[model samples]
Target: MDGWHDAADRFGVPRTDAVLLALNLYGLQTRLGARVRLQVSVPVGAQARTIVIAAGRPDSPFTLADSGQLFAGAELVGAAVRTDVDDAVSGYLRCWDGTAWRAATINPASRSKCTGCAPCPTSLEPTADPRLDTEDELHLLLDGLRQQLPHGGSLRDLHEITVSTACYESEDAALEAMMVLRKVLRSRRIDARIVLLSSVVRSREAFRWLAEHVGPFGLFLTADCVTRRNLILKKTKADLLPELMPALLADAREAGLDTSFTYIVGLDSTKDMEPFLSAMLPQVTLFPSLQVFQAHTPVMDGLHTPEADEFSYFLNARRIVESVMVDAANNLVPEPWRCYRSLWYESYAGQPLEGPRR
Candidate 1:
């Protein structure tokens, strides 16, 4: 019998309009390894309709046994059907309507949920002392570097300026911080890149603004995991990730900006052990920068404390990630190993100097 499946194969079906089919008894028993009973629905005017064709049950091949149309109107094509049966049925079949297949109505609520809304400011005022802004610290750091340079000096020559910030409660404050940094860098003629770490499901407007202004500079997204569950648990809005991330990265790349992903290891139970290793190991193609979780200076409360030996896990995970990069190089994946140095906590922050230089 002809059904949606046959039509789908004949004409490449879009996932948005695809309907699944299963034979009530024969197919269920064969596939699921159990005696099963089920019911299915079809359009009212479908051709080649077949009902239960049991030998002893009835003479007529097809019958309208149930009351009310299982589904109605042009919008019922991919709509799901619910049914129940007392015992296992013998078999089932589906028929296709002659004209174009029915189209299901899109739920407005579902569409809205999928489409992200504009980000609202969480608070009117800055949560921390405005005087304690990191921008000041950054300016001072740059000034210190300048003192060490020759008469005709530049910070661009020494260390590449890599700026990063945590996603606090307010997006307004974050933007403000970014703007301040941008102004300072431009004024000082410093060649620097900004990495905005946001836990929020960013609004399209925010992304557009970032692209238009900071698109030329580098941008990196920092997330706890690639999955939604872990993201939600970390107080991050999951709807924006994976999909949003790729879009942002694409835009940045097209704009000739450096794009990267930063992930902290040992963040969750799922992100530990084999699953974590497997998830991160193969992502070398993605060129992810890695950071290990430090037990001291906890970023979030109630995180699983890593054991002393777990340092080995971090090292091993790094090696695996590098190995995947090696494979990519061997396979000749274009732009394999971008050569961006991965930084560890101690190295980036620097080890405490035991004594002053003589």
Candidate 2:
């Protein structure tokens, strides 16, 4: 309840609704006795608030909830928060519209996207992504799609295809690959949309192309590192990302793109991560993802997982962002906590993520 109360305080979620959402999340622990963290998809005002579980491992369980594997009804109608506010903040949800930012309303995209084009995500791990360096490799990867589809699925079964900019030599190379991939999908008569994961640290042209042609997909900016000093993409610095992100996100937002930031937690000190997050939090729109670091991965670079208070970092982050940004902006901000858009916030009270409840 206290966790819910804290979330309600930050997100402006009603105590009643907070209690309900908390209970439902807690029910996961109560029933399965398996540890789970609480995560949300958007700010409270939207009519259809999503309770997306990052039930994904760093790249698995925490991502599983939204990765098209479970396909369950991830959207939870908040027991509260929807009202006139839903209209006011609807502009914010335009990013998740999965199509265009200015789109007045968005239908359940999966009905058309998920079913028509089950979305063949042609990918390789981003860290080792340079494998798709040339047209030959890109051609080979797309050609091999037939081998990658599910038991009976084919190219036509795809409504979405994920391409990570992190997996390319340059954003230009990635965009060129998209161009080649687009031609291939078109030739096959497969009308699949591309879901691009970009770091936004690269040249803006690739994303600019995506916004203009692909009709605005959620830009998941991957940073991987999280400390004040190392918070950066390959060559870009922390200072640059914050400045660069808003313009890109705002442009995408104006053009109708859902935007988010992704980082690895437990890779750096949460205390160092905190001030970094505080400085960076307000620069973001959608819930910035904090991927719980997994030790099993080959490259840890000497950091250990922070025993998973990872997600609750949001509540405090909300406070810091609001306090700081508010002082800077001189406004009465109504909603600062995007509790509904993040994970593990409730772990502080009772329902912990992957660990036994307190």
Q: Note the Cα lDDT for every prediction shown.
A: 0.35, 0.40
TM-score of each: 0.41, 0.44
TM-score of 2: 0.44
User: Best by lDDT, which number?
Assistant: 2
User: Candidate 1 residues 74-118, lDDT tens each?
Assistant: 233321132222121111111112321111111111111121211
Off by over 4 Å in 2: 1-130, 133-139, 165-169, 200-206, 214-216, 226-233, 236-239, 268-289, 296-358
For model 1, which pairs clash? none
Compose the digit string of candidate 2's lDDT tens values, residues 217-244.
Answer: 5565655555433422344223344445
lDDT of 1 at 204: 54
